[model samples]
Target: MNPVSQSRQSAIFGKRKEPHTVIIARGDQIRHFTVRPWIAAVAGSALAAVAVGYLLATSYLVLRDDLIGATVARQARMQQAYEDRISSLRAQVDRITSRQLLDQQMMEEKVGELISRQQELAARQAKIGPLLDSAADLKTSSDETIPTPAPRPDVRAGLDATTHSTLAGFLPDLRAGSANLSAADNADRLFVSINQSLRSIEADQMDRLKSMTEKAYRTADAISNALEGAGLSIAKGYGTSSVGGPLVPLDQSMQFDAVVDELDEALTALDTVKEKARQLPISNPAPGKQVSSTFGVRKDPLLGTPALHAGMDFRATTGSSVRASGAGTVVTAGWNGGYGRMVEIDHGKGLTTRYAHMSKILVAVGDKIEAGDIVGRVGSTGRSTGPHLHYEVRRDGKPLNPLTFIKAGKAIAGLI
Candidate 1:
């Protein structure tokens, strides 16, 4: 064998052949790639990749259908939740609307009921008017001249007779029964405690009146009988025939004139007592009034000057409920320029209470108020500085120190 040239041997044995290089595309970059001989030898590689791609596409379509179904189910559940929320909101709205309607209906019904009650009360008052007027006339007549009997009877007898005969002497009193009017009879009928010891005192007075009347009647009869007996004895002894004249009873008449006058005055006093007894003037006491300011002199808050405070102030919070101090019919309830919101209750004994400085009025004129019932709200109104109640007790249209009545009311309220 012969040796090759150095260059040719170097070509055959010194270095291996270079591999084929390929370039791959990358975003803004280049990659070098190399192929192996096995890759070159594989000839069905494209067909295989195409078959795999078709299979993958079919699988993807099936998965897509499942995803769509799942998405639809989820969307339906969400929609149902939204519908439920809307339904709940609609029910809430319906409830609110129903409540508002019911409130309006209830208010209307209450108003109608009140109107009916007022009408019934007015009718009752009308029916009672005639009896009241008759009593008034009797009182007026009694004030006039007394009728003299054919034979002048004792004034006390007439006075005693009136007690049993006339209810004016009896009614309006709460007392136990008597042949003649008794205070206990009146108290029982009226269901009122005029006073703790009132019945006892009235019983004593009635007894005295009856005693006086009986005594006067008996004495007058005795005097008349004596005069008749004397005349009869003198006439029989002398044997004369003539009817006795008014002159014959001169001494008895003269004596009885003063007695009759005394008895008459006494009967007048009794009648006055009866009138007072029959006056069922019950003062319903309530809780003590909380005073905010005092009556008399004070500096005006608005004017910043000294002014004679006509009425006391009662400090209370705004919208604090105002209560009626006594039972009565509401004579007035509305805004008065300086009084702000005010309510006046008329008690039968010529008494009335004025409540002022209210933020809201809850009662109307002619509405009856019970003791300790809410009538309005406390407020700063009508020449005032702060929220407070202005309470005034009046007698015969005159302002009085409300504290006296207020204190008395507190005492009574505690008992009640």
Candidate 2:
């Protein structure tokens, strides 16, 4: 081969395989090192690889720190949101509990008030029971029938149905802290209904008391009229008694108290009349025995001539029982001028009764006696021509018509 061709080939190949030279000189001493082409190439490649690795590592570290910070911030925000939600739920629960407590307290207060009213009504009833019974007696004795009052409402039973049911339905919810405004409103309505019922009962009681008072007044007035017709005054008998007190007006504000006071006064008047009638000579000495002669200006049985006779004569057999006409104390029991084996009784209110012409005297002076008590035996004795009883009535030592008393007694027989 030609030398020129070979040199051209070597030149191409040598350019690629060229070696690198490194030299170091300090002062006059100098050092040099030769590097082969392959060695230099390898060293350059290694340096480039190291530089790329360092850049990659720096970028990874910076990006990793940013990612960690972002993740931590997101987690903190989520935790704050959850905490806010929990706080709101807790506040709602507290409000509901507070409302329930308020409702429960109100219910308790209302119940207490209702119980107080019930107790007051019961006390009033206790006081009025006897008064009503007395009024009923007066009604029975009266000639004219009195109107009966309506039956009273049972306040306790009605209140129990209304108040108890409401409480029972709402109490559990309140205890559980679940009651709301609607439940409270319902309870209020129930309490109002109960109060209304109590008011109605109170009104009924007042009406009944008033009616009883009126009835008592009527009865007392009737008794007074009857006594007046019989020539007797209740006041005359009661006024002389040792009983007196200051008169104080009853308070009108307390309705029940005022009505009760009126009833008491009327009953007192009636009692006075009854006592007067009992003491007076108002009953027949001998029941079922016909009177042979009437009182006042009758002919004497012994003389058979017109004369002033101040007594009635009962046609009865000898030894028949002779009863006192009224309750009294015996004043005379022995024979007087023309009255043999006689008995005279002194009743109160200046009234007296006498039983004369008796076969036997059964009572003595100062002996207490009552109407229908056997005081003598019927017989023809003083100023009599046959077996009979001489009965007489006197007021303040003056003779009164015995028939008048007998009629009055018959009129009031069932009353006093």
Candidate 3:
């Protein structure tokens, strides 16, 4: 109804609003301000936007600092993990290296042991070689001296080709120290083969030693038998003088040494028996001489009567040489009662020989003489009907058959 009231109503309801007025009083001063509704609204909104922007900026700064810290911590953790992994890998490498060194050392020790065994075998061969040579020599001598139906195989041939080849192949590899861990299994097999070859050589050497011992015993027995057949007693023991030493026992652990000792004993026995056979008078006194009268009961040429003859009469010239039958010392070298111009030789071991009816005596009493040594000259003297020499063999002052000695000498001529 009124104009002021109408204008207020229009301003409240109109699309284009009116401005408002503000009054302020301070002491005696008074101020009035006008503000539009749209302007106030825009100013409030701007203030709200500025407050939001400040809050957002503060939040962003604080969160950025926290994110930087978290990133640095994560990087540190990753670095620590990598360091641990490196340490573990290093430990594994060290373990592998140690294992390889241990394997190499063990391989070296095994190879050294094999080398020592090879050296021992070589020493054994050195010892056996001499024995084999000696045995071969003995066998050869026996073959030449005695007659046999068939020739025997050589004992030295027992050393086979396998033994030599195995030794030759394995020794160089061992000496060079060329074995490695990669070839450990192969080295073991080769060592086994070499050991087998050494054993074979040892077995062959043992067989040869046994054979030599047996042969020596057999030879000694044969010599004893021959001597005994000729009415000669062999002494049980010989070499009583200049043969004294300590009685050292043999080493039982070394079988080869014991066997060699046994073989040497057998050879010594053979030598002793051979020496005894040589001492006996077993040779012809006058070689190529015709025997006119034999030993035992026969007709005497001087008396032409049945008598006992104690010697053999050899038909020879007046100046024929008469030699000693065996090695001895001359006991009588002068004229005797029945045997004129005689020479009596005293061989050791209760044996003696007599050369009777000699023209001249060349050997004197107590003169040393050997078999086939000229002692006198033959002649028909002192109860001899013609120029003939009488030869007699006696044992312990008892007469024996001279033909027995002569026959025995022929049988063992090659052996002596």
Candidate 4:
């Protein structure tokens, strides 16, 4: 059969169609068959695949950018939180550091004043040495001129190599009854340690102040010892003796006040500081609140008649906790006349505080109560009106207005 006829028969009989092809011819009769349809389709699919791959790359880059932006935002928020906390802590540290600086400054002023005073004392002590020596020579010693014949052999009684220094006056008997203060060596109040610290600092005022105080004490002691060795009392005398002391004339005798003037001033300043520390308020005091009724006067709440109130009436709730105003041992507890179920605390500064009209007592007579400790519940009790705690602050067997101390304490509390 012809090739064209066979091809037509295959088409007619439903045989698979042959692939379409194209041919290209060049000069000299060289020809090439075209690519098959399936091959063309595969090339088209590869081109499409390349295009999709390009889209996918672009999408990935966009997604990566978004992820980076999100991460950056999150980091920024976290950093802000940490920075805020750091700033707050820094502020607190600054405040505490300031307080320490103030305390340091105060201590430094005191120490400087003390050192100045000590120098004055030392000067007077210096003057007294020569004065006392001269006075002793004038009063107790007589100048004797030894008759000098040219080295008489009989006169030389045992005097060979060492010549005895001229005997002056006997040392004064100044050591009598004396109570040496252990703190006499201390020239200034010890500075409290620096409470807050920074990461790095060249110098802190607190440390400097503390050092100065220590130096003042040691220097004073050394000076005192030197004066003592020079045959003169640091003062006219340290302690009193039963024997009268004007053995020499008044004009020549060393003045007692001048030698220890610095010491006296220093002592006065120290006392001022000590008193301030003592008056410092403790934590929540029962007597700190405003007084509804004072201890002594006014008409009775129930009877509406003038009556003597044994203790101050502090108006508070029934369950409000009553605190001890200072650290002390409880000396009295339980019921007493007009002070029902009261607690009395004896703080060693010759001061005592009493809390009365308690609903419940938590401390006994021998118990040690620190300042701001809950000693009992406040309530109305024997010979009293409604629920109110009776509080009293006493000093040296006399009642004082607790308001003044309480107000001062409240002022301090506000600082904290």
Best by TM-score: 2
Residue 155 deviation, candidate 2, in Å? 15
TM per candidate: 0.32, 0.69, 0.59, 0.34
User: Per-residue lDDT for 246-310 in model 1, tens only?
Assistant: 65444532443444444554444434433322221123222343665777678787788998665
The sequence of per-residue lDDT tens digits that candidate 3 reaches over residues 12-114 is: 8875666888999999999999998988999999999999999999898979888898999999999999999999999999997786555455545544655
Report every candidate's CA lDDT: 0.55, 0.76, 0.73, 0.55
Model 3 alpha-carbon drift over 4 Å, by segment? 1-137, 141-183, 237-253, 288-290, 315-323, 359-362, 372-388
Give lDDT for model 3: 0.73
* Pairs clashing within candidate 2: none
For residues 217-331, could you state the per-residue lDDT of candidate 2 as single tens digits? 6656666677679897667333346866998765433767777777777777777777777887878899899988897786665677989888888999999999988899999
Model 4 agreement with the true structure over 1-416: per-residue lDDT tens digits: 99999989989899665776676767778676767778989999999999999999999887998989999999999999999999999999999778655544554454454344445445544643443332231222222111111211121222221211110011112112212412211212121111111101112222322333333334333333432342212332222357565565423123334323433433333334333333332334664455678656778777889976654667788988899876788999899877888899887656788888889899988998777889999988876777888877776667766655564444434222
Q: What value does the lDDT take at residue 99 in candidate 4?
A: 60
Off by over 4 Å in 1: 1-290, 414-416
**Count of backbone clashes for each model?**
17, 0, 0, 0
Better of 2 and 4 by lDDT: 2
Our tally of clashes for model 3 stands at 0
RMSD of 2: 8.3
| TM-score of model number 1 | 0.32
Q: Which sequence of candidate numbers ranks them by TM-score, best first? A: 2, 3, 4, 1
Global Cα lDDT for candidate 4: 0.55
